[model samples]
Target: MKHLLNLLAAIALLVWGTQLVRTGVLRVFGANLRSLLARSMGNRFSAALSGIGVTALVQSSTATALMTSSFVGQGLISLPAALAVMRGADVGTALMAVLFSTDLSWLSPLFIFVGVVMYMARQDTTTGRVGRVFIGLGLILLALRLVVETSEPLLASPVVRTLLGSVSSDLVAELLVGAALAVISYSSLAIVLLIAAMAASHVVPTEVALGLVLGANLGSGLLAILTTLKASVEVRQVTWGNMVFKVLGVALVAPLIGLWLRHAHPRLGDIATSVVLFHLAYNVVISLGFIGMTQWVASLMARLMPPADPASKNPLRPRHLDPSALATPSLAISCAAREALHQADLVEAMLVGMYTVIRTGDLKLSAELRQIDDSVDELYSAIKYYLTKISRSELDEREGRRWTDIIGFTINMEQIGDIIERVLIDIEDKKIKRGFRFSEAGMQEITELHGRLVDNLRLAMSVFLNGDVRDARRLLEEKVRFRDLERSYAAAHLARLSDRTVPSIETSSLHIDLLSELKRINSLLCSMAYPILEPTGTLAPSRLQDAAPARPQS
Candidate 1:
């Protein structure tokens, strides 16, 4: 029981260490990796190479798969290219297993000690996070050593020997067990290394370990498919396509495992070396064999899961809030920002239709714009929920601020939508239903204010996307100008009311309300710039400067 506990603890450490490395590398290099994947997807070869490099850095091909699948979902890369990336990711993970299979226990203590000191001292900085990666690697090395050490003693027990010997009785059953371990562990490389450790200890025979290796490879494909279950059809298609590649490779290799084992065992000397070499060679053959067939596999996937009918697609659904990306902070932040932009687009559509609705008193257009606001509300809710799922502690200062900015922008958009809907209701009730219009001067003032409001909305979106200091500063200035114009328009409307212009008198309340609401919308849009400028010291501490204190009793 104690030995089993030791073995389980070591395996848990392995999983934890893999997780720490995956997340730390992602948090540190996510933005760069996103850009790299984007650029590399222009071709199959480069895309696969990029996947290899990414998986090697993160120590988890699952993360690479998510990143690539996201790109395919966005229509940024073709399905074939994404599959190629997956192929490369598999090879990369195999390479990771090979690198770790070698004896490197000597470096474990050094890494853990330096990594601990750096992490404690730097704490929240990038260096601290890099140190975290080091710590994880050390733990992984240490854990692997412990797994072997502890499991070797258990092999001598009669009960343990009986249980272990059963796994070697049927090659097919042994293979399935390997696949299950991979899925359960969430890392084929970890499973492969563990199998290697067992093979070296004579806990499992060399040929039986090869069958398990085939099963482990198959299990990883299943893992990818399961992970992307909630993703979009396009993203899911990428996973399914990759799984097909894995299944085909496994089928071809499962029968040949015995042939290779019989021929290579004499030369390889030990079961551990034979297992790792076979794992590496199998992945290499699969990658080389199928790298050119991605397009054909992509076509098969398309046939299996045809695209949804466009007419049935919901306009209100959030496009960019990918659930898989939530595990990676930088990617999740980008998802929220893009969805916020989507919300802004709907709001812009409402704003553009507002002027025509008011001028022509067109109830049909008014109703349509109001309905569009419903979509806006849905997007806002989706984005807010998505951003909240991100762990703020994992984010650096800049990313934390971006997280806040996206939430703020989405909230403002939701409010602007509500206000626009109200404006439409007021227009439909007060003017269109009552057969009233603004006088020419009153209409002109409203036109100018509406035009400025639309311009500011666009500017606010630009500021949000680019975070340019100058653009942010300009947005703030435009807010003041918009406020002044609303006041000016109100004064002009009153002047016309005093003159008793018939149209102005009939629509006085609606006209004034429109000005007030437009100014409010403008205020919300301008709020985008404050976060950008605050760190630059470009914004005033308060809108009103502190008044000079008068000398005592002056």
Candidate 2:
């Protein structure tokens, strides 16, 4: 019982170490890894290579799947390219197993000591995150040593020997046991290392270890599929396609395991080396064999899981808030930004339709337009919740600021949507229902203001998307011009009222309120510029300074 407890504790420690490495690496290099994946998608081979490199760093193919699936979900990369990337992720995992199989017991203590010092000195900075990674590496090595040490006593037991001999004779049972271990450990690399350790101790034969390695590969694929169960159909398609590749690889290789054990085992002097080599060669062959078939697999997945209708009224389903992306702050920020643009798109539609609804006094159109506000509200909530999941401690200074900007931008959009809905309601109740109309000149002024509002909105979205200082300055300038236009329009309406113009007198409240609402919308649209210019010191403390009286008197 004590021996079993120690073995279980060692396995748990191994899993915890892998978790630390994955999260620590993501915190340090998440954005760079995302950019690397994005830029390397020029072709299938490069995409695969990018996958291998990223998964190796993060120490999990499942992380690679989530990242790649997000790129696909956001329409940044094609499905076939994502599929190819996942193929390389498999090879990457196998490669890590090969590297970790070497004896590194000497460095474990050194890594833990240094890691402890760095983490204690700077717990919140990037250096500290690197320290955390070191600690995880040290723990992983320690756990592997523990697993080997604990298994030796168990190997001496007659009952354990009987169980081991039974597993060696039945390849199918060994495969299932190996797969279960991978799933339970949540790391194929861990399982492979454990298997290699066991094989080295003669607790398990090399042939049985090979079958278990094959099972570990399948288990990793299964884990990826399970991880993405709640994701979009497109994302699920990517994971499912990868699983299909694994299944095919297993089917093709399972038959040859017996032949390899007979012929290949004698050549490799070390059983552990033979097991690791078999694992590597299996993945390399699978990667090469399936690289070209990614497109076909993607097409088949598409046929299996067709795209959701764009016009569906699913309010709860977020089009851009991919939960998997929350691990990488930069990727999560990108998802939020895309969703913000989606919000902007909806706001633009509302603004564009506002003119027609107000001008024509179409109360029915006004009611229909109100429905869009619900979508805007839902998106805002979803984005806020998604942003909250991103660990602020993991973000660098620049990324932290970006996180703030995204939240601010989304809040401004939600407010604008509310303002538009209110404007539509006022037009319906105060103007249209009361049988009031603005004078020809007043209507012309509102029309011109509305057109400029639409243009400024598009410009604001561009400024938000690109963070271009020049365009941000232009947006700020337009804000001032818009305010000036509002004042001039208000003054002109009063002038007509003084002249006793019938239309102006009848629609006095509606005209003034309409102009005020348009100005409010413009202010919200131009607010996106501040975050861009404030950091650069190009923005002034107040626009009123330009109109202040000259200091000549002083």
- Poorly placed runs, candidate 1 (over 4 Å): 309-312, 548-554
Model 1 over residues 324-343: C-alpha lDDT tens digits? Answer: 77767888898889989989
Compared with the true structure, the alpha-carbon lDDT of candidate 2 equals 0.87
Per-residue error at 210 for model 1, in Å? Answer: 2.3
Error of 1 at 205 (Å): 3.0
lDDT of each: 0.87, 0.87
Models 1 onward score TM values of 0.95, 0.87
